[model samples]
Target: MSLHEDAVLVLKAYEGRDEQQRALREVYLEHLAEHPDAMYKPCGAGHVTGSALVIDPEGGRVLLTLHKKLGLWLQMGGHCEPGDATLAGAAMREAVEESGIASGLTLLEGGPVRLDRHPIPAPCNWHLDVQYAALAPAGAVAEISEESLDLRWFAYEEVAAVADTSVVELLEATRARLGA
Candidate 1:
């Protein structure tokens, strides 16, 4: 199936933990239904983006990239590519690409951990972000990518201070999934 189809199925099957998330899931499903090109970056109406939070459970820390364009310390994720077969694969790919921890990084088994929709610059009004959590292998080291201004590992409690609410929320949901 196409990535668009995969996104539809993923969103349709997603059971949001809160009213806001549930509402966003419906919005995403509708967007995909209306726009066949919703999986790519050129969609003028905005598109579905995939992202994963790289976490090291044993170390009690998460890897965050300082986004070059936004200058915010955020999770490893970006626009979905044409080659992607599933939303979750796109997220995992971005996590590996951005975090530079390519080997042994695995996504949490329960599918996406959260969904975030936010406005972007002109020509693209919104980013419907499907977020997942990627667990880093113990002793994994990260290299800096051109897309980021910096890369750092932040402890569980330090996330709130360095990152925004969205990142904090993703981390919380990730930890909850890990039963931390």
Candidate 2:
């Protein structure tokens, strides 16, 4: 099946849940199905992507980036490509590329922490975000990318104070996975 078709199948699987979620996924699936090639190319729209919440092994901190476009501290993530075999793999690839972390970085074995959808402004559909969590050794420095204005480690409490409301759930999920 085409990526768009796959997206529709996945979204349909979640019907009768949250209204906002259903609407956002429907919008993305419709747009994507109408423009299948847009998936391979950067739709110039935010488009659906994956993200990673890189947690410190000590369980005290998490790596976050100040997104260049959104101007808010968030986990590393971006547009999915046709090359990705699965959504999880796509999330891992985007995390490594955006954070400049080595491919060898160990990711948690389970699936994503959560799925979120949000509009990316005009002329483009929303992003269907599959967020995952990974553990990195304390003191590991991220190579940082142009995609973000800055990368920093924040304590869990500190993160709660400043991170976007959209990301708090991810942080909580990551922390729970780590048993922090």
Candidate 3:
């Protein structure tokens, strides 16, 4: 199946934990149906982005990148590429690419951890982000990518101090999934 078809199926199967998440999923599905370019960056009407919160094996810290353009400490994630097979796979690929840990990073099994809709610069006004959690192996090492100014691991308590509320919320949801 095409990535677009995969996206639609993923969203359709997603069971949101809250009213806001459910609403976001509904709108995302609508956008997908309304715009053929919804899955790509050139959509002009915005597109779905995938992200992963990379947690340490001990569940003590998360790897966050200082986004090159946004200048904010955020999770490892970005636009869905044409080669992606599933939203979760896209998220995991982004995490691996951004974190520089090519192996031993496993996605948290349930599904997406959160949905964050935020505004971006035109021609795309928004990014409807489907967030997932990835567990990094104990020896995982991260290298900085050109897309980020910095890549560092932040303890659960330090996340709120260095990152925005969205990152904090993602962490909370990921931890809840890990039962940490």
Better TM-score candidate (1, 2)? 1
lDDT of 3 by residue, 42-93 (tens): 9888999999999994859999999999899999999999888888999999
Q: Candidate 2: what lDDT?
A: 0.71
Question: For candidate 1, which ten residues in a row score worst on lDDT?
Answer: 9-18
Error of 1 at 22 (Å): 0.6
Models 1 onward score TM values of: 0.98, 0.75, 0.97
- lDDT, model 1, position 13: 87
Tens-digit lDDT track for model 1 on 37-153? Answer: 999999989899999999999999999999999999999999998889899999999999999996999999989999999999999989999999999999999999999999999
Better of 1 and 3 by TM-score: 1
In candidate 2, what are the lDDT values of residues 1-180, reduced to their tens digit?
665555556555544235665576576567666766545436655466778888775758888989898889998877777777656667778778777777455677656666677767766656768677877865677888878899888888888787987688888866666676
What lDDT does candidate 1 reach at residue 177? 82
Pairs of colliding residues, candidate 3: none
Q: Best candidate, lDDT-wise?
A: 1
lDDT over C-alpha atoms for residue 9 of model 1: 89
Clashes per model (N, Cα, C within 3 A): 0, 0, 0
Weakest 10 consecutive residues, lDDT, candidate 2? Answer: 8-17
